[model samples]
Target: MKKTIPFSLLALLLYLAAACSTPKQRVPEQTASYTPASQELYDTIARMDSVMFDAFNKQDPDKLKEVFSEDLEFYHDKGGVTDYAQTMENFRTLFERNRDTGLRRDLVKGSLEVYPIVGFGAVEICLHRFCHQENGQDDCGTFKNIMLWQQKDGKWKVTRVISYDH
Candidate 1:
């Protein structure tokens, strides 16, 4: 006895066969929107920034030990790249050298932008001015900075830093 396939099954098989024969095009990656972060996240990052920079302003590299990750990557425009150890050492030397002169960093008003990184912590983009005593006058320079903060075990630390536009 001869058996015949059902019309619906045949049509579906043909459609699938045609679909399989066609070349597939890859979809472009979709980037997240640049929306403002939640107020809670913004506040948390702001506080963290304060903590980290406060240590810098105080010339206390020890305080930064908890703020930066052990495998931190810091990229500076003029100074190039520095790992965690070198970065910390540089900070120590800078702090020691400028201890008496005093260097202060102030965040430019309305220039702070915080964005979440999904599973990671957040990205902080801001303009800060560093001021120091030069020739008995305040010498300040404003620069752009991008910091990648990572959150783990209920603690936040900066994992990468991109400081440029000096």
Candidate 2:
């Protein structure tokens, strides 16, 4: 009597065939690294960053708003992405909530690195830490941020933000 192939064996063979039939390889492309920003530029950015964060820590929306571009795009790992208006709304909510507890953001010392983007503007890579006090309890954590700063209307404005690595 002739015997038929087992169902399990046939399924395994089919799966193996499907998986092995495709030869897939991911080739990564490289681009030139950004040029380092000049000291003067770095100093200017640092000062601007200081002002920006000071407003955040103090929950001052006006000061915080001035530092950002009207076409700002903010990306957060936990909260997703938003445009300038949404970001402002978020800031308003956050400021209202954390105003009493005194939320603060501090850049890790020597952790900020700046790069020039040839023509448009510059990029800032930095590690920042946040701390806040609430309900007689203290909480804190550190995260990474990549900010795209552009010059517009004769002043520097942050156009984009990538906040991640919590």
Candidate 3:
């Protein structure tokens, strides 16, 4: 007596056999990414940026401290990756050096741009000009930076800085 095999079962077996016999092709890794803009988020980051940079130039460590996450990864193009302590130390040195100089970093007019990183947080791209009024000399220069602000536990803190373009 001959046994009958169901059509669905036979088709599935044939498909599996064919699939198993074929060589698998490698899939290329995705290299494209997109981030959208958030105005409310921009307002928040703008406020945060003001809090951090203004206080920074004023040498207000307490106020400056409030804006950055403890695990900050500040990467200055020239200074390399600096952690919290190193950044504070650099700030201290900078503050000490420019105590009476009126050293300030001002965002270039209309250069501020913000992009949301979905759940991570946001990214700010801007050009800034650093000016110093020391003695009888007032000097200034422009630069650009990309900053990453992260959100954790409902609070947003600056986590990274790709500072460059002096």
**TM-score of decoy 2:** 0.76
Candidate 3 lDDT score at position 105: 85
Worst lDDT run of 10 residues, candidate 2, spans 23-32
| Stretches > 4 Å off in candidate 3 | 1-36
Q: What overall lDDT goes with each candidate model?
A: 0.87, 0.83, 0.80
lDDT of 3 at 50: 82
Candidate achieving higher TM-score, 1 or 3: 1
Task: Order the candidate numbers by TM-score, best to worst.
Answer: 1, 2, 3
Point to the candidate with the largest lDDT.
1
**Span of 10 residues, lowest total lDDT, candidate 3:** 25-34
Structure candidate 2, residue pairs in collision: none
TM-scores vs. true structure, each candidate: 0.78, 0.76, 0.74
lDDT tens readout by residue for model 3, 64-153: 777888888988878889998788788888888888888998876666778888779999887777888866787777777888999899
RMSD of each: 17.1, 10.2, 17.7
Which residue runs of candidate 2 sit more than 4 Å off their true CA positions?
A: 1-36
lDDT of candidate 2 at residue 60, scale 0 to 100: 88
Q: How far is candidate 2 from the true structure (C-alpha RMSD, Å)?
A: 10.2
Task: Quote the positional error of residue 85 for candidate 3 in Å.
Answer: 0.9
Residue-wise lDDT of candidate 2 within 1-166, one digit each (tens)?
Answer: 9999999999999999988887332222223444445987777778888999999988889898899999899999999999999999999998888877869999877777787777777888887878899679777777888999997667989999999976
